[model samples]
Target chain A: MDSTPEFVRLWTSHQAEIRRYLFLVVPRARDAEEVLQDVSVRLWEKWDQYDPNRPFVPWAIRFAYLEALKWRQRQAREKLVFSDALLVQLDASYEEEVPFLEARRRALQGCLRKLGDNERRWLWLRYGGHGAVKAEAVESGKKLRKVYYALEKIRVLLLDCVAGTLKQEGWSDA
Target chain B: MLKKTSRLDVLLGRAAEEMLSPEEATELEEILTRDPEARKRYLQYLDLHAELEESFQLHAVAGGLGSVFFPGVSGWRLWTGAAACAACGMLFASVAWAYATPVIQKAQRRTIFTENFEDRLAHQPTGLPRAPGAWSGDDASVVGAENGVLPKTGNSMLRFLRSTHAEENTPKSAWCDIYRLVELSTPPALGSRLSLSASFAVAPASDGEQFDIYVGLNALDTYPVQAPDLDTARNLSNTTLGRRLPATRNGKWHELSVDTQVSPQTRYVLVHLAMLRRVPGPSPSHVQFAGHYVDDIKLDLLPSNALPVKTP
Candidate 1:
């Protein structure tokens, strides 16, 4: 009936996108969820600050990034020492691989849907605990690095499948 | 223009992606040194690369963990959202309208009571001799005495004296001793507020002197233990005393009394006295009133404990 409806619709529509953004930015799942709650509250409080003419994704991403960074700083302060430099390097790599990154993420969604029950369970097991590579390396008696490289290859295949799905969506450049 | 722009753009994109190895990082730096345009392009790509990386990371996260993070618009929470907004509005309006009238009135009354409160004494001599009996039918208030005049102290100032070796050349007068006219005027109850006021004067003595005065309800053991020093004690205001009484210099008048609560089982009362003096030299500026020099002190008592306590 009023601007409230439009605002609520806009916020609800982007909830998934914003949540996904939070997951990638915050390395820990629980911390990411906490930041998601904080970001949602801040968005509601400062909803008037949003410019309807602009893209919501980028606007929402900016707030999410700040919240995630604050969480990381809090973690760093509590723990006393952490390898922030490694995160910086990985972030840099992500930037360089943006074109392939988006394609891979899209392909991952389709790959998840297409996975058979066994394959889904394998995917879960791989990322479930310490991650597939760590879990397998322990059992296979293979070197940790070798197991990690094998997992990396598997990730690349899944990423290729995500890219293929994006191409089907007419995202040919992806 | 198109060809040149295309060449510059390709180089810029490569630098942006950090497709540069250690050797390439050095080469890019060298190119930045040689050509200002190339350096500008390199810096721009670096900036864009940082922005793009942050964006990609955010997007990837949002895509993967959207549902677990935000629980996409279920139901029932719709009412909660509306209620919160309405409550916020109500809270703001109520806060804006609130005014603290009772608290302000209480603070104002406290300030007035503290400022106007006083207990003072003035010296008005009977001009009578140092005798054992009342000053010749001088009718001033005393509980058991037949006449109002007080019995004079022997050769001393009749409980109060004027100094023979006067410092100010002021005329000597027979000073009277100020006594707290005591009776069971206070009710035997807790939390009873009472105020008593009386005035008296000190006569110049052979040795420069001061007076000490204290008021105690019931026995002298109760209340704030000992009296505060006389230097800080002030006489009651003219409004409180009901009259503008005569003044004294060497035979200066001073008024002193205390305002305190009446405790349970209060009966006997007494006024403790001590002579005060001002020590000379690099001494303390403390003005001590050792003896009493008061005449015809008036007492007014307020009954503040009239209300009986309701038992729970």
Candidate 2:
């Protein structure tokens, strides 16, 4: 029996979640993506060994965690965001919060639409790409503090809105 | 203490923006280790940043490429043959261009009319006391809100004036209306949705009277010579009035809008901005229009049929 078909379906569907988990453990986004590529290849090769009874994500995430740890060792000491011990502890906590995080991510899409036009633009410039926010601030002659203040307000609003939506849908108190 | 709270907040903000230095990163890790609450806050901010980064990233989906691809290369070296690489690249580009010809068109919003009251001289040509296309009714002028708080866009807005205009509203009106007219040379195609959006603002004393505000639209072949009684009298079958709700007294600009399909017969659209209770002190009137204003009126047309799009 070819496990490639089922494995491909599962991997593609949950690739973003795995990438997000890797981002939490890996400090740099590019580093996370590099580790993610290796993990994908590793998972593909080991698909036949995966036990179908257990949850696919928790099983696959373990591989990602180990791969990220290896990548962190290859990086310069200054690049690591946390110590190895702290990363390991946080990985366990993140594994339990996967479902809740998925819910919050979905709610965030709706909350994004509720933001004002300026907030959306600022958010895109700040996070959409490297150095985009600084370029915009300099070109527009806006104070850096004012830009950060607007972004902070938007984050708080989205967090509150996401919490309210989750409550309304009986997702969680958060 | 606010000092400690602000410390965690600033660190989280720096992390989310990808601006944290190595030193700050160490501080952040120590704080997260010492304070569980700080750790939770860090997770929330990181989660938001991660999702945002996901959305910002390029999403390229290439379908049906597996069968057409050449066999996987072994120990590929880009500099091995530059001339051959250029030829191969051209071939791939041509093939991809032909295969990707079928594109999905994007939905569009066409702006028909937009006014922020910055330019007040553009009045509708009307031959009546007050009509839909022209700024009708009494005691309303475009003035800038002091302290720059009320106007939706620019500094200027249309304020409902109460100077000797209370007597005029009583005869046949319950609204002080400002009019804007958009005349279409040809009626919009069927199934096209005409959307009207306008922002209203008000600032009143806590004990001040309540003033009602409404937005109305009329789609007709021609403008009425005389201004129609917008609230009290039954309007023509083609009229649509927004709900008569009390203006919020929170000193914020609130947006109100009305959207309806433009039938094949609609030649002109009359946008009406009306406010009620514009008189002074007691008796027939309770709350007077203290700082009731309207600004930033816009008209948009969304075509249902697939249209040409420059953006997706």
| Predicted structure with the largest DockQ when compared to the true one | 2
Candidate 2's error at B45, in angstroms?
1.6
lDDT of 1: 0.37
Candidate 2: where are CA atoms >4 Å away? A127-132, A143-149, B1-5, B56-312
Please give the clash total of every predicted structure, in order: 44, 1
lDDT of 1 by residue, A1-174 (tens): 245554564566567657655544443345667888888887777777876523366587677766766677777654321134433433343333332333344346556566444443333333322234354457668786554334333343444455567565544333
Please tell me how candidate 2 rates in CAPRI terms.
Answer: incorrect
Q: Model 2, residue B291: displacement in angstroms?
A: 57
Kindly list the per-residue Cα lDDT of model 2 for residues A96-140, writing each as its tens digit.
444457557778888877766567667656654245567678878
lDDT of 1 by residue, B1-312 (tens): 012233344434444322335454445445544554553333333333333333323322212212222222112221222223332443332221211111111111111011111112112233211221122111122211111322222111223332221222324212222323133444434544345434444444556332233322222223222332211111110011111122222344344445544444544233222222212222232232333333333333334322221222
Docking model 1 quality class: incorrect
TM-score of each: 0.28, 0.45
**Taking the true A–B contacts (Cα pairs closer than 8 Å), what share appears in each candidate?**
0.00, 0.18
Clash list (residue pairs), candidate 2: B209-B287
CA deviation > 4 Å runs, candidate 1:
A1-7, A78-103, A109-121, A124-153, A160-174, B1-312
Tens digits of per-residue lDDT for model 2 on B255-301?
66777666767777777667775223234432335677888888887
Leading candidate by TM-score: 2
Q: Best-fitting candidate, measured by lDDT?
A: 2
